[model samples]
Target chain A: MNTKELIKANNDKRKLLTKETQKYYEDMLIYIRLSYDKSEHETEEILTEMLDHLLEAQEDGKTAVDVFGENPKQYADDIIGELPKIVTKKRIKYMGMGILYFLAALAILSALFNVVEHYLLDLNELTYKIYLGTQIANLMIAIPIAFLQLIVILHYLRWETFKNINKVLAFFIYWIFGLTSIGLFFVIIYFMPSFGPLIEWNVWFNLIIGVVLYVLARSVKSFI
Target chain B: MSLRTQLLKGILEGCILAVIEKQVVYGYELSLKLQHFGLEVSEGSIYPVLLRLQKENLIKGKMKKSPSGPNRKYYYLTDEGQEALEDFRHNWEWVKQPVDQLLDRRDNL
Candidate 1:
């Protein structure tokens, strides 16, 4: 048969192909055509290779659709379905990572609290040092704030809202963390007058904390 | 095509050019030619290859209005395409000669 006839036959068969399979064939063809100059025999070989990938895509799509059924929308909604297990596993991983992130922040904050008391305030030496109780107070407040930051980050990453909306939420979370940290810092200083001129290192440390909170909040947003 | 598919793309182009050399054809028409021989390539699959061939100045296409939806683009081999086809045809002969000869020698042995 002539080339036109051959092409017609191939196209007719192609018309019966499923959408996912057709997409696979189209993608493979695009790559093949773009990458190299090929011969007719080679073209046939590429088509065969594409046929394999198409079959694979068809199988995968079929399995996914079958397991998930039609409207298994959210991960929670699909708990009864087979595919929800995978989504559940991923969600669990995200939750674990988020908890770890906040815990790390709290751990650092707790350590810094102790350091500020010993180095910045003469708590043992002065009467105002009575308010040294505020360091533990800061830790108590920070633990919950850290949890909120994690959620905000997760929301951003998940694309639950428009990306810009998530970003705004992340910004607010950081602002709260930053202002609170600063407020706590100055509150300690306000009560303890003997606390020396704020050290260059302390200012830098606070700035670093602000930046870390900003980054953590943004990073979590992407994860959500 | 497997990993060896890269070797066939040029050959596919040569084949398409050879086919178009005989007649002006649309994208669908060319795909039909591949299919008739049991090659099983899809209809939309050939357009990108056609576009690449045209970009290399090997084939030229013109738009023709159809009674259906959109204008159909038909491609024909240019002089440059013919020259490339001839060159590919020559290289193909040389490449196949050794393989054919080996096969023949094996049969005799």
Candidate 2:
């Protein structure tokens, strides 16, 4: 057959296979997504690859079960079960980095608060002591929130939607918006009159810490 | 999993590496070759093996344009894959005798 004819024939076969096996493909994809939290593109690629095999088998007069085996679900489970050890290792690594980001964020924020209280805020000794206690109280609330935010960001990064973008670029874009929103939040907190005395530090500790963490996070791109 | 499936799972990675070692092949062709070797592996099952091999740095896949079709992801063995195949060969040789002896004794029984 000519290339055109072959292409048309292959396309027709693929369409037919997709239509006939749509339900199985969808089910398998759902199972994979639920089990592994894989991206849609990933699941689709797998389904299409399997369909290619199914098409080849169909051409040979075999059914899906004949080609895939008696139990499709079991077949999928086996496939996932046999995933490379590197996948798990990488995930654990990401989790580790996520924890580090959480801790680094907390450290930087704590340092920022210390500089603000110690140098920036204008108050008497007693009020300053009160402010320090309040700052400690504020951290108790902020640290957990920061941790949760980092986790959400990490999870969002894993989504298939960002798969096409360069990892470093994607990470920067997400954090640029994230850190900006956070900066705005602090600005709002700074301006609140009823929120008690607040101070802003002019030193470069926060910037330095932020830059160091950003560089460290950017360098460890294996997990993302 | 059944014993047969378990055994197949154990060797499937080496088998796939061996197939890619012979020639650069895409997913469909690789599946066909596996079938030709009398392995009753499903087309779906081969992908996980391919993915895992790629992850382990044993194989590398590149998308090459096809004249009659869209880009096909073709796989080739990396140096690591070659080294892994060599290791599998050595390990298989070591295990083969005991396995053969066990099977022969079963046959005799």
Candidate 3:
């Protein structure tokens, strides 16, 4: 009740923290180590906080370890729960890159069909010239789109990016949509001389489809 | 003091320091010596602490490839660690004196 009693009580209680509590602190350090990679300062800060918690729990008689141990796998299960859905850093970036590649392939294939349609169908000279240009331009556009796709894939697979899924999604959405729209705009501009007013509608339609497809792909990647 | 348990640990540290001062020794052999001295520590606990201590510069470590399983890390005490062991020995002597006196006095009473 008095100061000496309190001091003795505190000292005695300190002895009660138990080996299990120390094990809990050790387990926490292991958790931090597994979740993070190669930052000594971060590791040290985490350890210090864990030690403080262990000391406090020793005094309080209620360690977090106690709560966790009541269910043997509960601690591991909680960490497993904390994990960002099964989506890996590689997979998310792959989704973004994969979608962009598919779009590029689609555009190329479409332009090819147009070329064949014009020549084989005996279309007018002006239309044939424009279709030929469309095929050439679509092939040209594919190069940069492919490179951007590779960059996104590399960035996504990097150790830092792999830890978080949302960042990968954000980067892919930004680049894939941006690049594909630009590619389509160029395609339209290249054909503007022949298609004239029809070119504007083509641009908007392609842009809308690209955006819709990107969103659907990202949503699916997050789940699957 | 619960540090009573830590006394054997102190001796283990000294033995490790002495051995490593001579040549690098792998974990399994080091653990075997400690167990031979009747310090029943687990293999897992020993290596992790050795790694941590090595990181702290109390010791130095390097890995050698093994034909089986993974490579093994061999740890040796640093000059700084030997100096630390001397300080630990001096402090431990003083700390033990009073505890010894207290135990002796209880029997006399």
Worst 10 residues of 3 chain A by lDDT: A195-204
lDDT of 2 by residue, A1-224 (tens): 33344434444556676454645544554455454334333444455566666766677777776666667677777665644333565666566676556556765776667667667694223122234345545555555566566556544543433135787987788778688758854864475344445554333555576668756766665436
Error of 2 at B56 (Å): 1.0
lDDT of 1 by residue, A1-224 (tens): 33344344446655555875554444334433322223333344334323433343344454223322232223112111111122454455555555556655655664466566767884422112233345445545656666675455544443432123566877886688678866864665466433233322332344366557657756775665
lDDT of 3 by residue, B1-109 (tens): 3787577556666666666666676655665566676766543234334544565688876545544543344666788988976776687787888878788855663
DockQ of all candidates, in order? 0.01, 0.26, 0.02
In angstroms, what RMSD does candidate 1 have relative to the true structure? Answer: 18.4
Candidate order by decreasing DockQ: 2, 3, 1
Tell me the TM-score of each prediction against the true structure. Answer: 0.34, 0.50, 0.34
Clash count in backbone of candidate 3: 0
Q: Considering every candidate listed, which one attains the maximal TM-score?
A: 2
Q: Candidate 1 vs candidate 2: which has greater lDDT?
A: 2
> On residues B64-109, what C-alpha lDDT tens digit does candidate 2 reach at each position?
7655575566898999999999999898899998889887855663
Fnat per candidate, as a fraction, reads 0.00, 0.57, 0.00
Best by lDDT: 2
Taking chain A by itself, what TM-score does each prediction score?
0.29, 0.36, 0.24
